[model samples]
Target: MNFAAAVSVALNALRVNALRSFLAMLGVIIGVGSVIVMISISQGAKAAVDAQISALGANSLQLRPGSSFRGGVRGGSGSATPLSDEDVEALRETVPYVIAAAGIIQQRGLTAVVDGVNWSTEVAGTHPDYFIVRDWDIVEGRAFTVPELDGAARVAVIGRTVANELFPAGGAIGASLRISGVPLEVAGILAERGQSSWGQDQDDVIFVPATTMRNRLGGLSTAGVRNPVQSIWLGIDRARNMEAATEEITDLMRVRRNIRIGGTDDFAVVNFAEFLRARNETESQLGLLLAATAVISLVVGGIGIMNIMLVSVTERTREIGLRLAIGAKQADIRNQFLIEAVVLCVAGGLVGMACGAIGALVVESMGQFPVSIEPMIAFVAIGAAAGVGILFGFYPAHRASRLNPIDALRYE
Candidate 1:
């Protein structure tokens, strides 16, 4: 028989025993469905991590004071050797790879009141370069100009959360808001910045000029310093320059702080590029684990298919004998059985994909986890299903073709 005729006969045979055919496909259905759901969730998690890495800015470094030691007792990180504006100026002048540096000081649990509405949030004080170093964009109005920072102007920039709370009617810019009973004009509004990897709300704070915050609002500062700052954010010119820039920064800080050679660093420098690399490695490991599980599932499903095909050959022994007696080629008989197995798996795969898509949506809606279904994922699942059918169906098809025709016909 021709290939098309063989497929037609195979399909008709499966239709006659529809219940048995469906049972034979059950394993593949479950296996493919599980694989699809797992891949979607894994992809979504990796994507989220990647986005956070991007949000951290290119070649960025966070600088904070190291621990304090008093009476042989050590304090927490960033509790000693307070960073100051002078350090920021020194880095800008001395470090060749440094593109931007911004000193920041923060105050927490401050209530901001506009009209009768009140919202409690943190306030950050920094230079105009703060926006540049952090890669944060101002959606409306402008950042702290040089004059504004130098003069300690009473102007502010609000985040998305702060904007919504203080100005629900949508006119936040150029509005007057009071923090700690000090009235300030809203100069700008920041773009939405969702949440941090550590679960902090990025869009729930307010920003003001460092001088204004320090002089007017009593922001955190180093005692006895002319221009004190809590921490510094440095943006490097390029990613490849991170290591060299870090070494330069350390040397400069040590010299400025009067620390001897081999002494512990008084200030900590955190390289966000290295942190991003570590996160990428973690994502790769997770992908491999998920792939291994998918392979095991496909194998188990293939074994089930092989077992069913063997039973099918045994049940149709008389039919096979009659076909051989009628002068059918051995290849023709093998092709028919092989086609039947493939058809079963492919059909099961389509149903499995539908179930997997629905399952992904349900998971996302329940807020348990995020899911992403790409075209490549579905293509791979379907291709694997077809492959399973071919690999497992071959042995049974060969056995059916090799049956003894005359002896079988007489026995029947």
Candidate 2:
């Protein structure tokens, strides 16, 4: 018989056992759906991580004081070395690739009060260049001007979370909020940044001038150094190699800090470029693992198809013998069974695609990790199902084609 005739016969046979055919396709449906959902999750997670990295700024480097050792006891990271405004200036002057730099002093557990509403948050004091280094944008009002930084003005830029809690009625700009009993005018409101890669809420802080924080907010240096800071953030020139720039900054800092040659450096430089690469690599590995698991599920589904096809061959033995006796070729019998398996799998694949798309939508709507479903995802799933049908259906088809007409007739 021709291929079309074989397909028609196979389909007719499946219709005669509709319930059994559907049951046999169940595994394929599940496998395809799993493949789509897993892929969407992996892609979505990757996109989120990339966005967080971007928010951290391009070619950004964060310099913090390293641990200090005293009396054979090691202090926590950033506790030993006290950074200062002078160090920030020296780095900006010495490092040719440093495009922007800022000195920072940070304090946590501060309460902000406006009218009767109060909210607890952290605050940071930094130079205006911090906005450039951190890639932070001012959505309302403006950042600190040069005069504001130099005069230690009591002006503030609040993040989205603080804005929402304190100024639910809007008009946060030009409004007054008191922190640590110090009243400050809100000069700007920061654009929303959802979360950092480390799971910290990025949009839950307040920003003020570096001088204001040191003189007014109570983050003074223990070493009595003038204009001391907790950390220094630098934005490197995009065209320069980040590692080279980092090395130059480290050398400059060591010299400026009076650390002798061969002595352990008392500072740490965090290269954001390297951080992004590491995060991407980790995400890629996770995606590969998820893909492998989905593939295993598809294989298991194929095995199910194989078992059902074997049962089908046995149950239709008398029918097969009658066809063979009526001058049906062995090749025709094999093609008929193969077509049936493919049709069943293809049908299941179409349904699975719809289910997977719905599942993706549901996940996104639930505010879980983002999900991305591409057109290629559907194509891959459908192709995988067809391939599974062929791989598993071959053995049963071959067995049916090899049966002797007389023996098959007598067995039934």
Local distance difference test values of all predictions, in order: 0.86, 0.88
Model 2 lDDT tens row, 220-311? 75776888898899998873678888899999988887888898887899876577778778876887798788788888888888898999
RMSD of each: 2.1, 3.3
Instruction: Give the clashing pairs for model 1.
Output: none
- The alpha-carbon deviation from the true structure for residue 194 of candidate 2, after best TM-score superposition, in angstroms, is 2.4
Best by TM-score: 1
Question: Model 2 residue 143 lDDT?
Answer: 96
Q: TM-score of every model?
A: 0.93, 0.85
After superposition, candidate 1 runs with Cα above 4 Å error:
70-72, 276-280, 283-287, 407-412
* Candidate 2 lDDT for residue 289: 90
